[model samples]
Target: MKELRADIERAGLDTLSGRKAPRARVLLIAGRPGSGRSALAGELVRQVADRYPDGVLRARLSEPDGTRVPVGRAARELLDALEAPAPAGAAEDELGEALRTALADRRVLLLLDDAADAEQVDALLPDNPDCLAVVVSAGPLTGIADVRPCTLGGLDTKSAVEVLSRFTGSVRVTVDPRAAERLAEQCQGQPAALVLAGGWLAARPKAAVADLAGQLNADLGQGTVVGRVLRLVHASLPASAARTLRLLSLAPAGLVDPHTAAALAGCSVESARATLDDFVAHGLLHPVGGSSSPQYEVPCCLHPLLSALARDHERPAELQLARARMLERTVRLLQSCRAITETDSLRAREKLLEMPRSLRFPGPRAAADWLRVRRPALLASARLAVADGELDTLARRLMSQLVRAMVAHFGTRAAASDLYDVHGLVLDVAERRNLPRERAAALLNLGDLDARTGRTADALGRYRTALDAGREANDPYATGRAMESVGGAHLELGDYDRAADWFGRALTERLARGEGEDAARLYGRIGAAHTYAGRYGEALRNWRAAVAGHRRNGDVAAQARALSELARVQEYAGRLDESLRTCQEAVEWAGRAEDTRLQAALHLRLADSFQHLGDPASAALHRGTAERMLAEEALEEDSEPEHGANACEIRSSSAEE
Candidate 1:
């Protein structure tokens, strides 16, 4: 930090007490790879922390290979950092605008580390001058205007020696000053190289610095000095640990925990964890903080080197086997997670118990927590699995399990947006494998997500394609679901007549399959569609048939649902007396079914009917009853049961498609 004091002061940034100057509030810290640009950025952050009291926001703008991360993803990360709500399915321009607005009037220090080019950084720059951005890249960001550039070279010898001392201890460096100088010189005075050299020496306390210096000069004569040092460090590890190090390059987020490492190395969890700890001890991996379990990440600069080593030294079969193990482990874990979430399914409970204890979660909450923590890695694995064509079977099952797990943890509607990318991957796999059923399922799921996220046109298109696929597969379940989903989408779009037509077709499939209970449910859905279209007579007929079917099936809850819909249609048709009778019957069935919410809703319907009939005293009585029932149930309006399935309702726009 002291080495950059002159550059910091020369930037002419305003103090906290002063108004920021009307200039492009960006600073460029340009340097070559391995020149410690990121380290300098961190030091700058510490130095300027007090000046920017609002917050310090940091985002990685590029991969280690200098490939730019998508601007939209970067924008989303920034919005998350700011704690701003990003609208679902929003475009890049909208997200950029939100980010600019979030930065306005705030004193933030935005650190965009390892930026690839000018366009990448320009889009994320804050419009507010009060905010400051420090972009660290390999060269000056040419297109961005009004920027101050601070080019970084190799750390001077003194700073470089200080870097080594920090890792290996001052006593060690001082005891062999010449050897230490020789090592620093070998590193070309680069902080990154020095840190690796220092870490290697720090790990072997008894090894002389001079001997190690001679080994570096003799062997590892190719590649950058840092790359060769990494290879030396890697080669020094035990075979098991070395294999673990190479396999970790496959980790999706460049981060791994004990369980993931164990899966990759085909070792016991304890052994993999110990290997990870040893790697961290030797500075081969860096510890990433804020995890329940200890987590370590391979440094980005070492990725290509490690990957190359793995390819050269490890068999393709071995690597593929390792990846298969990871996918299988992930699939099992997700299956267990989904099992626990099926609170009402006795069979699911039995299956959960049958799973290996290691795969099983203690409870649903534990499963949910794991899902939240491992979402990124899990998604990344799914993507890679799909891309690896030979793993299509595993990928398909993995994606199916993920969707189920997410639905269980986050509910269908809430999980849809977050799992959108996974659904797309599922579609890709389905197309590649020519699995019509899977393709239909993926499209239907995506459509449901689009519907919930307000992409009406997209939802309709997905539903239509899903319907075609379902028909081609000759899958009744998929076809029925797709038909109903199309109706749901039309209902969302206010195309009530079309919704009724689709719902009627779906009902025909359910009835043909002799799924009496499901048919009853679909009848109610068809009734809703008719009601929405103001075809009260058609609604009444379908609801009456639904009521009869539920009665035959001995489903009191379904009977109550049908009768409630019957009452609604009667009221809409101005048959007040009939509606009152139907509502009373619905209330009786609701009480029998112990559905307090349904009872409250029926009472509310009775109240409305009485009020419309000009009977204020009766209306008040029913209204009071409705309020008391709702209070007893503690029910919120439109609140569905957290457990148990319900008849599909073709509700208004607010319904989940």
Candidate 2:
């Protein structure tokens, strides 16, 4: 704390805006794991916590294995700690507002420990300048503004000796002070290593400290000080305890609750809990606070040792078996989670129900809670499983199930980027296995995601690949979808002529397959492209054909949609009376379809047509009706964007069909 204080004073103050102000309200303490960064941050908070009357709040922002805690999850934790009520499934930005609002009037000391990066800290910063945030992280957290950085190295020899004496007896250190100093030197001044050495000595009260030091020097010839001390600590444990410790390296996110530990160790949850508690007591693992279950994690410095030990002692088959169990358990949990969110889709619900239920969640809430906590680990597992080609087909199947579940819970747009990596993995597998149908499906999905994110060029490229794969697989449905996507991408890029050509090709295919409804939708897409290109004659013909097809298919809503597009083309062609008549009939169709939003938007279009015909009173009446309907209920209006002040509007809503 004293050293940090000196650095803080050196950082000085800021005088921006012609006024003196403290340089930073946030302090960053960066160090390696097991270097006592958390302890240092805690001490700093203790020294100045009383300065902020609202109280101090500390949050762990990453798992031990270094997966960043999702921003939404982190915000939820902060709001919960602040006693602020947050709506369920709130977005990350919404949760951020809730956190900032809760902290707005309070002068608080916030300690964000084990932060993965600066973004995590930035999202959780309070709006109030009176609040202070002390962020602890392994990284330097560069490029963040107004941060006072305190980098922690190993402890000094004096502090190290005191730590050892506190853990061991002072008399033991007093008897052979030189040997004690040598032991601290061997520890490389790391507090964790020193404590482990102390615990080793404390466990054996009569053992000579000098002899143990010599033994370590002889046994661990070229190893790091941390590695040497960890070996000694791990070696002293019982066989079962040591085995459990090694298997814990397989634990997801390096976080081990009782149930997870039991799966890894093939034991009962109660027994695993007791074993973890014993490790906590002996300082082999640190107990995580603010968690519902009694959880413990091996220190990061010691984690590598556990991994190496597991690889050396555990058989390959044993490791694989354990991993499979964890994956299977995760798959079952995701199935339940995806099932609960699929209330509207019967096909998706049936798929979820057909999945084997080796594990069961008590309710939907429990299922959602588990998925929220374990999403990172589940994704990590999916990537690893896909990369490991020798694994069973169950791994790939699990990945598919997980992707479906996440997309069901979060909308496609919200979850697109999160699922992109997994989609890439699936594509790789399909290409490697020479499965043309799967490859086409994967490419189509990726192209759709790219289009949604505004990557028009990339989307077009992927769609081309999908089209070729679909043709190779002799799948007409895939081919039609790919063609449509390519046309949509062209439309997004403002290449309306090319878009119209591709939509024509797709429409031909749908008509040949007797898909009348889809053919109607494709015709509407073609009409939109022509309208965008200022080709009113071609646009009018395609839209008329679209309306006839929709009427033949008995689709009242779709006929209303097609008629709305036809009205815009008619208005563009200097036929105000015809346009006004088409819009009126379109409004009647929308009413029959019970689509209030579409009805209101058509009324507005009617008003536009009337005004163009030089009739102010009729225009005003239609405009008033549209406004009244829009205000009565929450609805989204779809209408053409008006071209050059008096020209016709070009509606592209049919492109979504």
Tell me the TM-score of each prediction against the true structure. Answer: 0.89, 0.72
lDDT digits (tens) for residues 1-657 of candidate 1 = 554445445545354436555533777888876787877788888888788888899888875434568787788778877878475556789888888888877888899988988998989988776677888888888877656678777777787888888878888888988988887888888766787787778888888778778878877567887787778887877888888999987776666878789999999888988888878767677887764646777777777887888898899999999888888888888999888878899999999888877778888888888887787677777877887798988888898889889978887655544577788898999898898998998898788777766888898999999999999999999999989999888888899889889988998889888999888888888888888888888889989989999999999987998898898788779898998999899989989998776777777677777777788788778778877876766645556546434432322111222
Once superposed on the true structure, which residue ranges of model 1 sit more than 4 Å away at CA?
1-24, 46-56, 63-67, 80-90, 98-109, 339-366, 635-657
What lDDT would each prediction earn against the true structure?
0.80, 0.77
Error of 2 at 139 (Å): 11
Candidate 1, run of 10 with poorest lDDT: 648-657
lDDT of 1: 0.80
Which pairs clash inside model 2? Answer: none
**How many clashes in each candidate?**
0, 0
True-structure RMSD, every candidate = 4.3, 8.2
Give the CA lDDT, 0 to 100, for residue 61 in model 2: 90
> Candidate 1 has what TM-score?
0.89
Q: List the residue pairs that clash in candidate 1.
A: none
Error of 1 at 123 (Å): 3.2
